[model samples]
Target: MEKLVIGLVQTHDDAEAAAERVIDCGYTRQEVSLLMTEATRDRCFPSPDVAPPSSTFGAAVAMSVVVPDLGFVVAGPLAAVVASAVGAGITGGLREILITAGVPRHWAERYQAGVRQGGILVSVFARSERDVGLLHLVLDDPHMTSFHTEAHRHHAYDTSF
Candidate 1:
């Protein structure tokens, strides 16, 4: 099997908007890919003008859900959506949606359980060397791991196939 260097980034947007940005940026559905959230589409990326906030989770859930629906294979996002703000509801909600979206039911349950126990929920899967390279450039952090390791004990493998 050919190994494509993969990199992941946490993104914010709905499928249409994320797809639009990818297409508008000159990448075809083949060259660049993204996963977006329903809330993100519903909220329009939460304009900088807003105060008190409107949503906790955004494109992360959408990405997880849409991964299987994409016509082409999708590399995963690097970071899972962590309810960044306070008063966010049970972390299980996001996990449940994502599991139902693409994650295996068993893994999804464990992953969500991990989150409730203070585990990180986001991960990325790269499909090509170019994407992996670009991901590092976008993040600009060398310390980040280039590939998955045992540390990600709760992560789910790609289930699209």
Candidate 2:
């Protein structure tokens, strides 16, 4: 159980220009997916499940943003009861809740009780571009990006059933 490299910046463009090319390459958290559009995911995370799967338009709020050290845009939780209500001190001890493994806890208690003014992070797993370091500033078609480890397994930490 030792692997970490998630830099999947698959884009059609516009999530702030894929978060400004994932913050100019230094990298700092990313797993967004608006796959469909939905007004560019509701102008970047003003969500109500934007809705886009068929074709018309939907599926915005593509998330996963935690520009730590680089500073700003700090929010995470791609599900799991909103990362266990954002309880634990986030990132430390890997307390992203939803039973652990990153982001949740009511979207980090609504971004630490500020009511979320920032967002990005909608990856249900499968992120390995070498644990994410801007990965050459967004895939750039290295065979449509490549890197995987078990791909999907689910059930992390458990949080009691």
Candidate 3:
């Protein structure tokens, strides 16, 4: 995998809707993890087996997609989501958030540059009538080959999630 794109969707009323938006953006139903505020502390996963707590925010779902080539075609939806989620597109706060979420600073910079150079965005994160918090996005470093190899190894043996 060249990049691991992670997106976080927080909604106050309809967690399901936010989840559906992620699904609509091309991620499968299984790829998205729905976490309620009560089931987690600060949206972090404590353990693999622990269930999330109930939150007044309703739910915070995390979804991811791995891009092997790091091409524009594969990153279209993600770019769109980032563009829409952050009002100023890929600059200012959104750029900072991506870096904070584990996307290497260099990769984030390149992504922004690509967008600025005229890349087409197909779809963005779905907006809801209810309060929707920051839609965080991260693009992991492409130079890390060992993690991809391990993931491939596990993927070959285990198809269940």
Judged by lDDT, which candidate is best?
A: 1
Quote the lDDT for 44 in model 1.
Answer: 36
The positional error of residue 142 in candidate 1, measured at the CA in angstroms, is 20
Better of 1 and 3 by TM-score: 1
Q: Best to worst by lDDT, what's the order?
A: 1, 2, 3
* Clashes per model (N, Cα, C within 3 A): 9, 28, 4
Judging by TM-score against the true structure, name the best candidate. 1
Which 10-residue window in model 1 sums to the lowest lDDT?
Answer: 66-75
Candidates' C-alpha lDDT: 0.34, 0.32, 0.32
Which 10-residue window of candidate 3 scores lowest in summed lDDT? 152-161
CA lDDT, candidate 2, residue 50: 45
Give TM per candidate: 0.28, 0.27, 0.25
lDDT per residue as tens, model 1, 48-144 = 3442243233323334332222211122332222222112342345454445345556555554444333233223333444544443233222222
Task: Give a tens-digit lDDT track for model 3, residues 18-123.
Answer: 3455555455544433312222222332332343454311222222222212222222334333334344433454345345434567544543343333321112
Better of 1 and 2 by lDDT: 1
List model 2 lDDT by residue over 57-139, tens digit each. 12223343333322223233343333343433444322233224443454334323221222322232323434343333342
The residue ranges of model 1 lying beyond 4 angstroms of the native Cα positions read: 1-92, 128-156, 159-161
